[model samples]
Target: MKQSSEASYPISFRKREATTLGDHLRHHNSVVIIGMKRVGISNFLRFFLHHQEVPTTYIRNGAQLLTVIVDLNDLVEREIYPFWVLLLKRIVDTLEQSKVPGELKKAGQRLFTESIQLKDLFFTVDCVQKLLGQLIDHGFYPTVFLLRFDRLSEVITPEFFGNLQRLKDAAQQRLSFIFTSFRPLYELRPDVFSKSSLSVFSRDLYMTPALATDMTTILNTLQSRYNLNLPKAVVENLVSLSGGHVQYLHLALLVAKKLRKQPETREELLELLLKDEEIVLQSEELFASLTKVEQEVILKHHRGLPFSQELQEKGRYLWETGMISSGKKEIIFSPLFENYLHRIDTPVHGGTEFTKKEHLLFSFLKTHEGILCEREDIVSAVWPETAEMGISDWAIDRLVARVRGKLKAQKSSYGITTVITRGYKLVRTS
Candidate 1:
């Protein structure tokens, strides 16, 4: 069923004044953008463009703008000419489609019409440069081309990669490229990418599920924009449950709002939420994206079986998807999905088994079992550097206590022990 009103919950892109992924991409000259292939990077870019009310977004002291998103999925892959043709078409369309001032709009339309008349003119690299130069002539200054390459590995040949570098050089930093890929670029091909090509894409930006740094701002915007009456606690818990995944968080809230009665508990909330068809379909899609090896890794982690260190990237990806979370010691699937995974009476392993922070703490303790880890060391390892100031000794103690309780609840033999004048140690009980 359709969960919520689109107007109520807009695409959840970052606000203008705030530093967003868009802003970061815009301000920086070089960016090799990596994101979950499924999480809709294109959608966010579109939303940002729409929010700016134009194709151009102001950056660096109210100067410079642009985000031209080309979904490679919509275009034929492994071909250069067709890709360029389609790309030029998209840029022209965006300029025509955008609500830019009259001159820019006319310029865009003119580019579109001229390019169409020229037909195969943009088939060559120089021709493509000429086309973009025309846009510059028309005043589309400092435009950032956001190319959404579905399976970048498939499209990116050594020749194609070099071509992209040439395009960047041709545009003279006026054109910055943001390419998306499912797996890491290095994993795709180390040899094909020349040093010059690598240098252009040297600044790698890993796109996580959502911008965790902007969660507070996002939550605040949601509450105000939607006029939601959710208690601060409820809102905070929603953040926790969603793991700051933008879409999942949006879906969860929509489901929460759809419930006939207000949910007094998290279980009640989940029950209401899991009923949404969209949620289930999205969850299935997430699982489907995993390879057998990836699936095994998740299943093993769920069952408390060991996963390889080599799969850290995969694990991190899964965690970003909100399907699983990492504890300091283990990876855990989301309880909502974990419960669904185990219908019969077999015990599910680590999920909701520990908070993310606690998991980090426990993971550290587990790794350092029998060694006394000072509070300072623990804080440094588990918490973000920015958060170190707020995390006091008492805060660490409380977190350790929570970990101890969770361990006991799981009937696990592992526990933490405080050492006088030292720190703490992870111990196993018979």
Candidate 2:
């Protein structure tokens, strides 16, 4: 949904004293803002820049380390360089007025000496230490703002960290360093820096995409920003489907809003959700990644009961990985995923033969609920040539018992039921 410029979502700042950038800036000289992509790291940085008075310099992507150093030197030398150039020009003008030079005058000999000697010198470790000492003498302290430390980790080599350590040692309290990373610091090499000098903000400390609390904040923001009264149920469903990932939730809301603008009814919202290309693509990808055994389990469970041993194993794996939940003996995929699965065609497993006779037997029992089918009828439906082949009644009884045992094992109260003498019936409790 396109929100007006005036419409801004109120960011829910963490309640803890030292959590946010503003809060940390007030107390600590250096603060690191880190989180997953789209978790509002940039927004937080922008917030502090807008609200606070500190000299904020954002190092975007952190790839241009050398450029940053050159820029810093240029900033330091701006005033002096201009004045020096002006003085040289003035001296040349005075000499021309005095008519001291002939060819120098004809050539308009304007001396422009732009020296980056000091800047080039700072590239060396010893020279950088000396430069820091000179800056301290001149009361030119700098607070280094290193944005996207994750990007830096990718771009910079091991020598970069070594040089950074030297820079830190040389500057000491005179320079404050703020490093931001998307990934966890622990995931990186530990020998990169001393723990005391570094500050880490991880998913554990900050709200992660999977958290319910973060999802609530996102829902509230969407409602307030769009001025749309999103139903609580709708928000909950979106949260459950997206697993509280902000980008995914935003996409869902955007699609819903677009559909709502078409003057659709509330009931049509579910259809809108289902039809959204973003959701459809993500769901398809999720289903595609699942194993064939897992798909079989889902399909078999959806049909009714009698799960194969392989299906049960896959179900247990899915449950452990948080893809689904097991209730007693019943396995349930998440509602969102289940709905998506229902919309798609059944997937094929290996070419294992399914008993058609078993299907017919179950179908007959299901059709005649609470009524037993005769042995002759059962044979006719399940095994057509059984009478001619002289298949005993015990064989049919064993098959029924196998079906019942499977049902019982899966904790399904439905399936084949005993009828004492006549035959079997499917008990429909629901």
Candidate 3:
């Protein structure tokens, strides 16, 4: 993040993200970038490679950058051997295409050819390691970018990642990688990450909102293609509706094309937005991309209600992703979205939706339903990450009261029974 912002603030949203990757590469660190669905990270990486932001701007210490991009989306075999083969091939391509000395190119070609002939994963990795070492020795810092690197973590064994970590460690961390995936690293592979160095992340870039220039570029392109006028006011409402999501922002225009001829006010546009099937689906999808805690924070904040500082910390993701703007008052950026949130949260019975804290308390109590849930245990469950912060008794009682009220309102089969001193337990109602 320091690297991304150290330079002047970027006018292009993805450039800001790209700048962060460049900074990490300069420091010899690896980064895994994730974005929400339909955010078009593929195009973003394509932009990075074409622009040469790293080679042209970063890398000032008399070292050139060696970039090998392997778009994993093209992988068909789903086997480790094929994966390694594809990666080595790309490194060879990068070496051949980039302006490196003939000796280095020859060395890379030799290893690549040998890896192809050997048919062994370790051998292929060894070949890659040898070339990376050669590049560094020749005043080049190598960075391998794995695009659409979504499923590799699921398919590849832990050994493959261990090898990758070793490769980086051997480089003294000079070797860096950039991975673009649909899901963030935290959600991508939490299982294998538990016992691996991949968990030691330096930075994670979420799908960012389109900058002002980006929105203008899209609108201009659309105006010329469709031969329809893009009104300033209508466009403002579209940005609000789409929350800076480029594809959906463009889609919003096409969806509302019929209503564009008239001077529809923002409220009128929102009304149409709620009824349009396509727009409704788009809004619901954007909402669904958020986690439960994220959902609660946004809903509370959207309604001008106060959100806890801890929960607000979670909500920072919303601003980073461009789902909301933090001006004088935080804006949800889409009125139609409020309606969607309300509809989904409508209680199946009398049970209203629980906020993040309430949900935490209820989940713990229900998990220990028949047994006594000690106060200490509840603290661990509800605030496991911040138990050292020391929640007050009043705060705990307030949380419990809220959960009890929700359970009673829903007429759930379960109820909370407080023990005299130690704890609480769930009891069945008649």
- Using lDDT, give the best candidate's number: 3
Model 3 CA deviation exceeding 4 Å by range: 1-19, 40-44, 52-62, 77-81, 102-118, 182-184, 194-201, 221-229, 253-288, 295-328, 333-339, 342-430
lDDT of each: 0.58, 0.48, 0.68
- Tens-place lDDT per residue, model 2, 146-230, is 5545433333444655555666567654544556554335444455544543543211134233355555665676667677776
**TM-score sort, best first:** 3, 1, 2
Give model 3's TM-score versus the native structure: 0.62
Per-candidate clashes, comma-separated? 4, 0, 1
How displaced is residue 63 in candidate 1, in Å? 4.8
lDDT of each residue in 218-292, candidate 1, tens digit only:
565556655677776667666655654555566677666655666777776667666654455445555555667
Residue pairs whose backbone atoms clash in candidate 3? 351-410
> Distance (Å) between predicted and true CA of 100, model 1?
9.3
User: Least accurate stretch of 10 residues (summed lDDT) in model 3?
Assistant: 1-10
RMSD of 3: 14.8
TM-score of 2: 0.39
TM-score of each: 0.58, 0.39, 0.62
